[model samples]
Structure formats: structure tokens, C-alpha cells
Target: MDVNGFQVLPSQVESVRLIFKRHPDIAVEFRAKNQHLRNACMDFLLSLIETMCQSLEDLSNEDLVEADIALTYLKDAGFKVDWLEKKLDIVKDKKEKEQSSLARLQEMEDSLLKLKQHCSDLDALVEKEHEELSDTRTPMSFDDVV
Candidate 1:
């Protein structure tokens, strides 16, 4: 079947859909926060396919040339897709690293707070002991049977 400027075999659309479904998370990441771009790309591709299908009845030499042009356009779009995918992968990795670092920092903060509290408690205990020892060490009575 003709799709856009490229030929769509029976398996082509299905294959594309399957690939996207298989990597749904990646697809979502690539389309992240930009429904407009995603929608535009999908619509453009679909329309190109529809035009190709409609032109199939008039498959003359000129039509063939047009199809070649369309195919080139589609190929360029594929390159863009590849670039977007790579960028998404990098973004995901960066986010994961940031999250990991944040978690470590939070853990360190909690540990530091606990250690500070423990030190404060120890200091209070030591001060109490010193006071107790001072109380027990009564000065020798000056008037005691000298």
C-alpha cells in the first residue's frame, strides 16, 4: 500500500505501532510536555500516507517522482525522530542521576541530624555527671578536729 511518499507494506503501520507500544515509556518521554509537537508529527505522517494512498490510482512517472520526494521527506523526519530519541534518553539519564543524588543528600542530612542530637544528649549527660561529682566532693570542714 502507498503511504505518504513511501510504500507501506501490510506490516509497516503495524510494525510502527508495535514498536511505539513496546517502548511506550520512551515515546512518552520523547513527547514529554509537548502534545503539540507529537500531534503535529503524527498528523503530518498520517496525512502524507493518506495522500500517497489517494495518489496510487494515478501512479504515473510524475506521481513516482512526487512519491520519491515524499519519501525523502519521510526519511528526514525519521532522522529527526532518532535525534529526539537520543535527546530523551539523555534527559532520562540526567533526571535519574539527579534523583539519586538528591536521595543521597537527604539521607546524609538525616544522619547528620541524628548524630547532632546524639552529641547533644552526651554533652548533657557529661555535664550532669560533673555536677554530681562536684556535689559529692565536699570541701573538708575547716573546723573539724583540727
Candidate 2:
């Protein structure tokens, strides 16, 4: 089977099927590993679209006329350009949100580290004061009271 531009051999597909049959939870594992695979596929599709757009921009008038005719046919076949655009926009928004969440997590980690250091410093100061107090001793005699 051809997935995007990559060919999936029948043997490989069979192997995956066997694994899934043996362990249904493999679906979750596969999904975890497929996150990057999905991202790569999306990136490939985006770049292909960008290259196509650039070529369209540089097309001759005759080619533009032909492209328009082809586009109309594609639209008639239920491939709307606006729908593709909206899908891309959704992916872009998801990427932005992921990045923003990562940045906030990093900020929280930094703050936690600083707070930890402050706690350590306070502990050390308290320990030093305890040691100094222990070192200083005073002896009292009955003569002093008299």
C-alpha cells in the first residue's frame, strides 16, 4: 500500500496486523511512535503544497488556463481548495499551542529550580547558626549569683 509517497510492503503490514491481533493495546504504543511520523507526513505535504503554489505562480498563461480547467475538475470531484486551507490552518494552530505550552512548562521548571536553591540556602544558614550557638558556652558559678 502506498501511504503518501512511501510504500508499505505487504509483509510489513502483515507483521503489524499480527502484532495487533496478539496485543490490542499495541494501538496506543503505535500511536505514541506515530506522532513524529504524522508530523513528518504533514511537513512533507506542506512543502509539496508550497512548491506547487510557487510553480503555479511562475506558470505561463497557457499553463494557467490548463491549471484552471484541472482545478475545476478537482473541485467537481469534491476536493475544495478552501477545505484544504482550513485543515492547514488547524494544524498551524495546534503547532503554535504545543510550542506555547512547552514554553510555559520551561518557565515553571526554572522557577521551581530557583525556589529549590533558595530553600537550600536557608537550610545552610540555619545550620550555621545552630553550629555557632553550640560552639559558644558559658559557665555559671554560685559566686556570680552571690
Candidate 3:
């Protein structure tokens, strides 16, 4: 997909070519051995990682399948995936916290609006009652007072 203008939605071959251009390890590895097969392998690993990542820096849980695949592959490759898994957990926590905060904020705003409408309605009722009472109120004369 296109994350931060870094489009990785192209063919695996193109992705491998780009990766090779940027990182020499995959290129050398692929070239040093079963070039055609290693080319696909490197592309697959990178694709899994690209799906797991968000804009190449932040971790995202939006694509857990991708993360799982990448992690499983790396584990099979004898690489430790604990650190990456922990990073994913952190990302998931952050996302949950943000969602909760937004929900709370929305509730507060709705409550405030309701209160304001109630106050306005009360004010209008008071004004109408005052107008009605004034119309029926009798003026006292000086003679009646004496």
C-alpha cells in the first residue's frame, strides 16, 4: 500500500529490485545463491514487514496477519521476534487509549450540549411566565393603600 508516499503495492519483483537498490544484503544474498528463488523469498519477507509496519517507522496492528506471517518466517529463520512483538503490543495499547479518549471526549461534549439546551428551555419558560403574570397584575391606587 501507499504509506507516507512509499508505495509498496507493486509486483514482488519490483519491490525486490527496490529493496536491492536500498539494501545490499538481500541483493547479495539473492545473487549469491538461488537468485530467482531468493529474489521471491526476499520480496516475500519484505512484503510481510511492509504490511506489518505503518509508514516504515511506527508499528501498526491493523495488519496482524502480515505481522504474524513475518514473525513466523523470521522465527523459522532463527531470528528472535520478541522485540518486534513487544513493539506491536505497544502500538495496540496506544490505539486503544486513543479510542477511549475520543469516546470520553465525545460523551462530555454531548452532555454539555444537553445541559445548554435545558438551560435555554428553562430561561424561555421563565420569560413566558413573567410576561403572563405581569398582564394579570393589578396596579394599586393611593386611595386603596390609605
**TM-score winner:** 3
lDDT of 3 at 59: 41
Q: Model 2, range 1-80, lDDT digits (tens) per residue?
A: 54332234564445435433554442232232354564343333334344335432353445434544544443443333
Top lDDT prediction, candidate number: 3
Q: Quote each prediction's TM-score.
A: 0.44, 0.41, 0.50
Query: Lowest summed lDDT over 10 consecutive residues: which window, candidate 2?
Result: 24-33
lDDT of 2: 0.50
Candidate 1: C-alpha RMSD after superposition: 18.0
TM-score ranking from best to worst? 3, 1, 2
lDDT of each: 0.54, 0.50, 0.59
In candidate 1, which residue pairs get closer than 3 Å at backbone N, Cα or C atoms, i.e. clash? 4-48, 4-49
Model 1 lDDT per residue over 58-98, tens place: 43445445545654554454423443334334544555666
Candidate 1 has an lDDT of: 0.54
Runs in model 2 deviating more than 4 A are 1-78, 137-146
Error of 1 at 8 (Å): 29
Candidates in descending lDDT order: 3, 1, 2
Q: Which residue pairs collide, candidate 2?
A: none
Cα error, residue 38 of model 2, in Å, equals 24
